[model samples]
Target chain A: MSQLKRVQQWATFARVWHIYDAAWQNPFQSAELLKKYLMGMHKPIYHPMNDCGDHVIVINTADVALPGDEWKKRVYFHHTGYPGGASWTLAWELHKKNPTMVMKKAVYNSMDRSLQRRYTMERLHLYPDANVPLNLLENVSNQIKQLRPKPKRLDEYKEEEVREFPKLIDLPKSYIVE
Target chain B: MVFTSVVNYVRARGPDEIWRKRRIFKLAAHFIGRRRNCYSIALRNVHRALAYATKGRKLKRADMANLWETRVRAGCEQHNISYETFREGLARTDILLNRKTLADLACWEPYSFKALTDIAKRRALDDGLAGIKADTSIDRIITRGTLHRDK
Candidate 1:
């Protein structure tokens, strides 16, 4: 056998995807999902030193919800150099002030702190509502799965689907409408 | 309530006189030049600045994109993979990583980048015969999520 080692060719690249904000799910979890994209951890080409993450465009920031009392209890603090400059802004209060900042911060802080964090942040585009410009929306190629299932509206069920459901028992003629 | 033409009191927007008259000047405030203060010059200056802003944005995007492509290309070179081969392999494998993110990974995460190169190399070899068709854009190129045999 020859002493020389095999030298194969070809390089790998990262994949990016988009995420949308829905009121029903956890933004924190979604932030990690964003991080996964940014780090390119989801792909076989992912390396710890590589920034193979994808762009995440989030919309509907106005409707993002926090569990239980995070809205009231959570506080973002800021201090100016002047006396009594220290002040606190609650989560909901901050959200009211700038709807996009809440999810943006969550996604930002979720990643491992490094110089590239800001670069990853640049790829994250947040919008307050569903009214995204056509140009921006057109670039989105994929989506991350949501933690919570979207609840279906009553009227969303098709007539055929309702009819197809097997009935366990038939109501007697004396059945009264509740 | 009766209106008169003489000595009309304009409801000043704020306490500062300069600020009150800053309707057109506010547009020039962002510009760093003597023209920002000079009213006649500021008028034309603001118009020019607004026009340039649109063009500047497009140029800036192109500039950054070029830099990112350069970075990704350099990263591929380091791993002994040609940029063309790497890009083609990735596209065939359905990996849609944009240049910015790829360059980022190239700079910050060398090991991850190496792993990516390794995969691309393997996939490139399997490129011709194994035409594994997956429709979704988010389909995992590496993971053999589905099993099918040639009939």
Candidate 2:
């Protein structure tokens, strides 16, 4: 191959690093999105036997949002291989113990049960907050957009902006101040 | 040469026997143990391997087609468009590009693929196709269908 063609080949096979902000994003939905990058399904050269997967750096996993009451309702099961050693941990409880565990498990379960699952998981780096190592952060050239927009909290709005908001009815002068 | 007795005739083997066994042996040359050297075992393994090869040919095509679709879908996702919508938009606009070619463009010529997606997005929005977000701005795009309608 010519020098240009060889370089093109290398570019095509090169593994890319992507960064994702998991704050207020659904872990389950994010997992489905991240799984594509982790398994290299986003690449044209992807194959079951080929190692074309990319690295994904997820930050702010502790702030991930679960729809409805999943945080209280979802249960993670584990067994110690001994009789009566089974345990079930609620999603909220697990998150409190390890902030990144919920997001990590979500991505882990999203992928197919294959021999490469562990190796693929190794490429995923999750941080409880946006404090990633400088080395890893520098490697990220792309950003995976969140599945849904992060909802703005009422507290996040400035007092001036909130006070000027339109109202359908004027408050009565006799209305008691809480 | 005619055999003098019925027993001699029964014992005589055809000259093609060696060639027939050699063909099976040739296919089983890569096989291990008795399966490679023993004619009976080699023949059975060789037949199975040939059957797999015949089936594998069709499977390879299907696998490639699936891979192309995956690549194209991934490309579409990057631009915030669904694969079905992208294909539908392109079809409606008469782009006529196949999955293999679209996949090749997506991997090799990313800019070209992006342009294709932009065109598809415009076409999809113009037609108000389902599944489209309707958030994309199509002010600058001018498709053949749009030109005909404008005139």
Candidate 3:
């Protein structure tokens, strides 16, 4: 190939490093989004036989939100291949044991059952917090936008902004505060 | 050449049977075992292979188109633009590039593709295309279509 063609080839097949903040994001929903990048489905050159998958670094996995009461209602099942070895762990319990496991398993289970699943999983880097290794952080050139905007807590608002906010009706001084 | 009798005509095949079988065998040359060496088996496999080849030709084109659409969509998503919005915007701006070319630009000529997306974004915003919300980031992109429009 000519020099320009060779460079184009490299550019097309280049492995992009994407960073996703899992804070307040549902793991299942995030997994579907992350799967696209992990498998390089976003790329035009993506093929099942082509190793064009990108590296995805997911941060704040510990803070990943489960929709509604999923943290308590959802269960992860596992079997040890012996009698009475099967076990079920609640989502919250599993998350407490390993903060990254929920997000990891979500992405794992979201993919199709194929021999390439394990290899593709290898490219995913999950962190419980934002403290990623410098080398890995340095490689992240793109950020995957959160599916839903992160909800801000009342405490997160500035005092001035909160105080200046419009009120439909002011509470009486006699009213007891919760 | 006229056959003297019906028996002679039956004995005389139209063409060389060996050469006819050779054509089928040639197609199945890569097949393993009896399929490659045996004429009847080779013929059956060759016919099936040709049918698949014909179907695969159409499938290949469709697959490539799908791949190009995927690549172009990826590029659009990277720029925070939906594929439909991008295409609509491009179409409105009179940029008639096809998916394959757009896909090529997305992969090999990223800067050009980015420029195209910028134009598309501006057009989409101006036209108030669905799924394209106004954003301050693309406000600075000035396209010819917007040049004459009231702000």
Candidate 4:
């Protein structure tokens, strides 16, 4: 018998995956990607009751970008039982306080609202930068691509590159070139 | 009003002897016993049947809801979480799943349901500020202090 057939009979449930280098990527698309693996929806053998999900290692979340003014407009609300204990936190404020929280929340809300969702959430490990520890890093057997193109930082451009690029319009003398 | 040389019971109804052919008896047509043909008995039977049906409709709904709750409770027990805690936690967190779906998840899809219980358990603990003590205990790992080299 083939090894593939043998493995098929056992129903190997999950595998860990790494999603790195998503700097300045859209959180919405990232959330959508995470949902597929978290729910095992991408698997051929996925069942509603089964926990055959893929564990996701999300690193470099500090540079995640939200389209439009969502950073200021999006509000997260939580309330305590007391008379007036409700608290609202803006996206940018949350990002400033904890860089990984935005991604964590995105992934958390994407899953089905059940106790199983918590377990799936546990599988999603978030790191603010590329420096994920050695142990968790080893568990990652696969690497997933980013949802959107990474934004090129200003520093990434070559010193002489500006001269070669096309100019759409003649700049005014007062508009000093950077 | 003028009274014509009126045609009252002088002519026979022929094959359609329908003195009892009002809407009430028509509703009772499918009923059994003397109620099938006898007007008075049919009227009473129809009234009783319709009344019972109206009441039973409400009761049937309640009964189904109760059954779903019972299943959900059983599922909770199977998953080692109390039904009340599960419900309260989900409700407080605004998870907002109805009992029918919860019950279905519990019975046919145990793992999916177990996930819901986990969320409930977390919410219950987080419900600390709400001054509500959690009724169930779920295992949680809070920190990863050090990284180890794997073999």
All candidates: DockQ: 0.02, 0.52, 0.46, 0.02
Q: Residues A1-178, candidate 3: write the lDDT tens digits.
A: 9999999778877899999999999899999999999999887566777899999999999999999999999999999999999999999999999999999999999999999999999999999999999999999999999998999999999999999999898888889577
Q: What tens-digit string does per-residue lDDT give for candidate 1 at A12-75?
A: 4534457665556677887876676666654434454666777777877777879899999988
State TM-scores per candidate: 0.45, 0.76, 0.73, 0.50
Docking class of 1: incorrect
Candidate 3 Cα misplacement greater than 4 A, ranges: A1-14, A41-50, A68-98, A112-115, A130-135, A154-178, B1-17, B39-41, B133-148
Q: Any runs in candidate 4 off by more than 4 Å, and if so which?
A: A1-4, A9-11, A163-178, B1-151
Best by DockQ: 2
* Fnat measured on candidate 1: 0.00
Positional deviation of B57 in candidate 4, in angstroms? Answer: 18
Clashes of each: 13, 0, 1, 8
What is the RMSD, in Å, between candidate 4 and the native fold over all Cα? Answer: 21.8
Q: Between the candidate structures 1 and 2, which one is better when assessed by lDDT?
A: 2
Measured with C-alpha atoms, the lDDT of residue A81 in candidate 2 is 98
Task: Write down the TM-score for model 4.
Answer: 0.50
Identify the runs in model 2 with alpha carbons over 4 angstroms from their true place: A1-11, A82-86, A170-178, B1-27, B32-58, B78-81, B109-115, B130-142
Tens digits of lDDT, candidate 4, A58-177: 888998998999999998887997989999999999999999998888878776688788888887888899999898888787777776667667678886786667889987988976
Backbone clash total, candidate 4? 8
CAPRI level of candidate 3? acceptable
DockQ of model 3, rounded to 2 decimals: 0.46
